[model samples]
Target: MLQLASGSSLLAIAVDRFLRVRIPVTYKSTVTQKRSWMVVAICWFTAALLSFIPMFGWHNYNTWNGTTQANSTSFECRFFTASSRSYVVNFIFFGFFLPLLAVMTGLYCYIFLTTRRQLRLNIGAATESHTYYQKEQRLAASLVLVLGLFVVCWLPLFLMQTIKLYGPKIEVSSLFVHIGVLLSHVNLAVNPIVYAFRIPKIKEEFKKLYMRVYHDGQQH
Candidate 1:
């Protein structure tokens, strides 16, 4: 549920950035500060409701039998291992795939429209628009990189899970599942660096910090 809400929030930001660039006047009126907060609130509410529903008897876990127990611990709990394939399928679609698809679509569409607009600008407007367009292009490229990283990190996990659920029965090694999960987690670590490198202000701050550390080392 948290994942769903986070993805939705990111998607909203991407869409908002695109609209601000493409249709500034209309976007100002339609996506006001209050409206943006409202969108976030809605995402949170929806995620909470979906997540809470599973707690009300949808989730199935393996039952412990004394003879069949893997360990002597009586408090052991294993979730998502039961015969409830439907729950897994629904989680994949709603929690990951749908939100990812929406974000990717919005980002690519924004890139396309920005490129078209750049190409169509008149000579008279070129000088006035050159700096603005350049900045937009940089930001868009950064976002594209971020989106690519997101796909790379999550796609394998998503695909493997989907296959495990829907494909022919086969033994899937725990090592393979662990690797996929690790790759998915790598995104959380990489995102901040991606943003810092892409944004001019953040990049500048990074440079300043680097220089400060370098100078202090030299003095010592």
Candidate 2:
């Protein structure tokens, strides 16, 4: 669920950025507040729908061929144990991650190139264009940072899932999955810190706190 939400939000931001660069005039009118809310609702609905599918008889315990469980002993719940392997391979990897990632990457790349070209032209509204391009450049850079961090934090888990699904079953596979899970959790923590440092108001407060802490440490 966390992954679906984060990936969806990132994809939304990338698409928004692409549109803002590609169609400045129509972008404002097209991306209205009401429509934005609609997108949010759609994301939530899709996440809920996909996650719930496992419960409706598409699970490892009761999916595809037959009961995969060898022992009848009830164990601690795990994703692979509960969710269908077919679901993980088909939807999670190929359906969601691959397509979403491909689109977002293409959009960001287009935005980067367009912004650069606009700067090179610099024909009309010199000051305004300069400011706009600079702002766009900063935004592009920030988006890259955010997206890169997201991939860094989340890729391991997905890769591990892929290996777990396809690769030969081994003892170390469990360790890799555990490490991947830990890394995914790290992303949840890192995103807030990254955003907080980027926001003007929050960044200013952070600086103030840092200075105060430094003074307190020096005095002691």
- Among all candidates shown, the one with the greatest lDDT: 2
Local accuracy of candidate 1 as per-residue lDDT tens digits, 138-171: 6777777777787778777666667777784966
- Model 1, residue 156: distance off in Å is 1.3
Best by TM-score: 2
Q: How well does candidate 1 score on lDDT at residue 83?
A: 26
- Model 1: pairs clashing at backbone N, Cα or C within 3 Å: none
TM-score of each: 0.71, 0.78
Residue 156 of model 2 has an lDDT of: 78
> Model 1, residue 151: displacement in angstroms?
1.8
Lowest-sum lDDT 10-residue window in model 1: 61-70
Give the Cα lDDT of each candidate: 0.68, 0.77
Candidate 2, residues 15-83, lDDT tens digits: the string is: 788888888879899999999998888787787788888777777665345555545575433546677
